[model samples]
Target: MTKRSKAFNIKKGDTVKVIAGKDKGAEGKVISVLIDDQRVIVEGVNRVKKHEKVVNQGGGNTGGIVTTEAPIHVSNVMLVDGEGVTRVGFRREEATKTRADGSTYTVQRSVRVSRKTGKDI
Candidate 1:
């Protein structure tokens, strides 16, 4: 059986700072996540240019040099908090929730916390 990997704390739309690589110290919002490859694409980070040939499509033939952000390994980036870049930690908390039957139940939820500040992110 294949094992499923745990989800990363850094989600889409999260602000992250690149810690290592050519774009080190660059900060930008996360564009997408590649869980299988353990990589992420950050806005304005790891940009690369691609040359393309013009092709005729249903619309029109419009192709040229396209520059876009490339995927960066997740380990090279750190989540950014109000203080600065911080490591992520998980915290379990009990919370009460209402069910469809109007019954209250206590459930445990895992929340992502900042290691540096010791607060929920």
Candidate 2:
């Protein structure tokens, strides 16, 4: 048995603030979301050093101690809404879609919303 990836409200480029972790209170844009791992990689957060072996191929990439951002658990960060941080909420709204044949249909689409301001995220 393995864990499955679920839909997460957080997305790449969303600004998030670390709530509980070594980087508490630190804020940065979300670089990527790892749904399966239930983790997120925030820009400028969770920095780690990785050592690599030099590969030899015509102009092979240089390998050494490299600093990179590591993934932090999603529970450790909160989305930043304007001046404050808030929880992510979902709102279903009817949206119109057009088919290739020019036929239009209405569908309910879930939109990421801010729990604090009741605004779309």
> What would the TM-scores of all predictions be?
0.89, 0.92
For every model shown, the clashing-pair count is: 0, 0
Clashing pairs for model 1 are none
User: What digit string (tens of lDDT, one per residue) describes model 2 on residues 1-121?
Assistant: 9976788878999999999979999999998888889999999999999998898989887999999999999989999999999999888899999999999999999899899999898
Q: In model 2, which runs have C-alpha deviations exceeding 4 angstroms?
A: none
Writing each residue's lDDT as its tens digit, candidate 1 over 43-71 gives 99999999878889886658899999999
Name the candidate that leads on TM-score: 2
Report the Cα RMSD per candidate. Answer: 1.9, 1.3
By summed lDDT, which 10 consecutive residues of candidate 2 come out lowest? 2-11
Residue 92 deviation, candidate 2, in Å?
0.7
- Please report the TM-score between candidate 2 and the true structure: 0.92
Backbone clashes in model 1? 0
lDDT of each: 0.93, 0.93
